[model samples]
Target: MNLETDLGGIKLADPVVMASGTFGYGFGYEGLIGPGDVGAIITKATTREPWAGNPPPRIAETPCGMLNAIGLENPGVEVFLSEYLPRLRKSGAVVIVNIAGRTFEEYVELASMIGTAKGVRGIELNISCPNVDMGGMQLGTSPDMVYKIVDSVKQVTHLPVMPKLSPNVTDIVEIAKAAESAGADAISMINTVQGMAVDIETKRPILGNVFGGLSGPAIKPIALRMVYQVYQAVDVPILGGGGIMSAKDAIEFLLVGAKAVSVGTGTFINPRLAMEIKAGIEDYMARHGHTGLHEIIGAAIL
Candidate 1:
């Protein structure tokens, strides 16, 4: 079966993608899965300047998910292009850099700088990072702000630009529409839902940042509903993801209308999950009498 798919201007050999932050520049999983193993690898969230990240206790585990306030930690874009990108290129992974910024100008600058950098297949604008004190979810919540940022960035980057939307908004579909109106090549749905965990004994919050992006299976349903809603509303390709722990979860997203899916926190439990999911998707296609992934992409939508 042909598992090939496309995310805007970038094409994929399959629908499995190593979600940003979880894959860590693709080199982190070199021993477990090769660059050609899955469709793509979205690097850790990069910033205009290096971030120290949130303090101790930045990660806390909940019932069926993980809460993180890593705070976009990275060696600024200059270091990324000079150091990380070359190593990622050498690893042969199809690189899609995930970028975040503290200001509107920062967003435009990072897109321009990274889009022109060699070895990058596309860019995923992380306008929905909720762990930080500024920019991230702030610039993402409003349709007007979403439009302005995307439209401005579109002017500078030649590569396909996809704005990853935050799930914290009242109406995520409106935000997705704003992005498409601004000429977004595609839309990446449901960046971690805003949530927090607490320490019962200490009577305090568990995360160092007090609040963090909640990921994993607990948010999967919310992610699915958002992707389904956006799919019905937008014309651009959707990279559907959130809480995908197995092949079953990935397939569910495709049924709802995601052209491709990104596997995140699930990788922490199984570094080889992407490959496993890819195989499972193929098995599903065969049993379902589907010859191509497109045949199953949005087959369940009604």
Candidate 2:
């Protein structure tokens, strides 16, 4: 079976990719699985300057899912370019860097930097991170903001640009179409849903940020629905993910119109989840006599 596919101009060996944040800099789980075993590696969200992140209790476990307000903690772009970029390039895998910034200028700067950086194949603009006070989902909620940010970044970079969409919006299709119209090569859907947990006994909030993004099986149905909606709204490819824990779950995303599927919280549950899902897709393809992934992508629409 041919699992290879293209996300805009970037070529992926398969549709299974490790979501940003959960995969670190793309080398954290190197020993567990070979770089060639999966399609691409999306590194953690990096900012222009280093962020210390939130205070204590950044992560809390809830029923069937988890809540986190990690606040986009990272060593910043300079550290990543100087230290991590070279190592990831040597891994012989396609590397897609996920970037977030506090301002429009920072976003453009980050894109321009990564666009010329070696070993990077694509850029995933993280406009929907719900954990931070500035940037993140703030820039994602407004369709106008989405268009401007994406357009600015596109002007500076030739690499495939994907604006990750926020499910927190009233109409996700509007934002997806905005990104597409602004020259986004592709779009990724369903960043963690905004949620909160309470310590009823102590009458306190569980996370230090009070509210956090909810991820895991709890948000799968909602994510799938959004992907389907965005598929019909935009002409660009869709990278779909939310609470995908198994190959079957990934297939469900594919059926709904995702050109690729990202494994986020699922990686925490199983480090080898991406590889397992890749193998499972291959098996399913062989059994059903499907020659390539394109056969099942958006097959559910009819």
Candidate 3:
């Protein structure tokens, strides 16, 4: 039952964590998986101010995946701290706040705020969000920008910083290395692939934003490949995501060197998916006579 893992200095009871955005704030899914059941609760992407998000048709179903343009509609950092943080502290889970900022100073400010917050475990920088108007795609796609953003936030906070990477990049390895060199404690990646859907009948785009990022089974292979390449390029821990619906999905990430696996679109399909994946991983380790999850990290390459 050694599912425990480490993300820099933060230790987790397991390698399964709920991905930001998909899990909403920490309070919504507590009924399905207790705060302690999974390794960590990565909250929704919060901005410096409240966002109304995009108009209707924010989400649309795809074959094996889904596209969304939720636009990071959050209650703002002040509201989150004044309201959400108090309830999250009691959930019995490690609170990892996922934050996005329009500029370098904003990110630094957000990180510093979270560092002083009592219940926060770490900060997962949501640098890959394409649906937002600010620094999501703008900062994540370029290695230099990624480095600069990570550097700015690292200077302000002592808490572990996990820079989430975008899949819509020419070279993920390059971005991963940039984040590592810029002082990122860990890197979470393959946020979403840029995509669009159209309604044949109306002869119009499906989502309000016209283009949304894709998630779910369709992007798993791409996510794994990025994580594997990133693992080879840097020594920092990697949090791999993008379509992990089952334990087998999670194992694929571990085998490729992900320190932990984050559940995204899968939670929409099954709220208890993280718990099921955790149990499945345990069952797998027992049957194979492998006693710990760490043993599987990068094992496939060996």
Candidate 4:
């Protein structure tokens, strides 16, 4: 079966992508996955300036998943260009640079910067960050904000602009529609559900941030539902992901109209998770006699 897929204009060797922040710019997985092991590697979130991330106790184990408020920690886009992106290209991995910024201008700046880089296949805008200029509202929570950010970034770069949608909203479909209207090349759905965990011992929050994004098996159903809804509403390709721990989970996302799947928390348990997910997808296709992803993508929607 043909697993090759196109996310925006970026062609992926397979449908499985190494989600951002899970691989840390693809350097940690050189020993685990060789060249072309996965479709694409989304680098950790890059900002205009280096971020120290949240305070300690940023990650905590939950019932069937995990909670994390890493706060988009990274060494800044300058370092990524001088170091990480080059090494990722040499490793033969298709790279999608995920970028975040403090203000609207910062987002555009990062887009222009990465667009000039050598091997970046596409750009995933991290809109889940607080809009400090807008009174700390998440840029993704407001449909207008989503449209504004995507529309502005699209003007600065020729690279594919994909806004990663946040789940912490009243209506995710509206947010996605706004992105599409703003000329987003593609859409990345369900950027972790808002959640928190408290310690009965200290009678305080387990994470220093008090709240974190939830991931793992616990959110897969919610992710799938949201992806299905957004797929029906938008015409652009969808990169669906959240708590996908196995091939079946990834397949579920495909059936619901996700053109591709991004594996994040699952990778933390197994560094080579993308390769295994790819192999499992190939196996499923052969067993089911499906010729290509088109047969599986959105097949269950009807």
lDDT by residue (1-302, candidate 2, tens digit) is: 79988899889989998888887876657588767777888889999999999887999999989999999999999999999999888888889999998788889999999999988999999996432445345789989989999999999999999999889999999999899999999998889999999999999999999989999999999999999999988899999999999999999999999999999998888889999999999899899999999999999985
Instruction: List per-prediction Cα lDDT, in the order shown.
Output: 0.90, 0.91, 0.88, 0.91
Show model 2 residue runs off by greater than 4 Å.
129-137
Top-TM-score candidate index: 4
In candidate 4, stretches whose alpha carbon ends up further than 4 angstroms from where it belongs are: none
| Candidate 3 lDDT, 86-166, residue by residue in tens | 988977788899998877777888898888999898999988643244434567988888898899899888899999998
lDDT of 4: 0.91
TM-score of 2: 0.96
Summed backbone clashes in each candidate are 0, 0, 0, 1
Candidate 4: lDDT of 69?
95
Please, what are the lDDT tens digits per residue for candidate 4 over residues 147-229? Answer: 99999999999999899999888898999999999999999877888999999999998998999999888999889999999
The runs of at least 3 residues in candidate 3 whose Cα sits more than 4 Å from the true structure, single-residue gaps closed, are 129-137
lDDT of 4 at 256: 100
Better of 3 and 4 by TM-score: 4
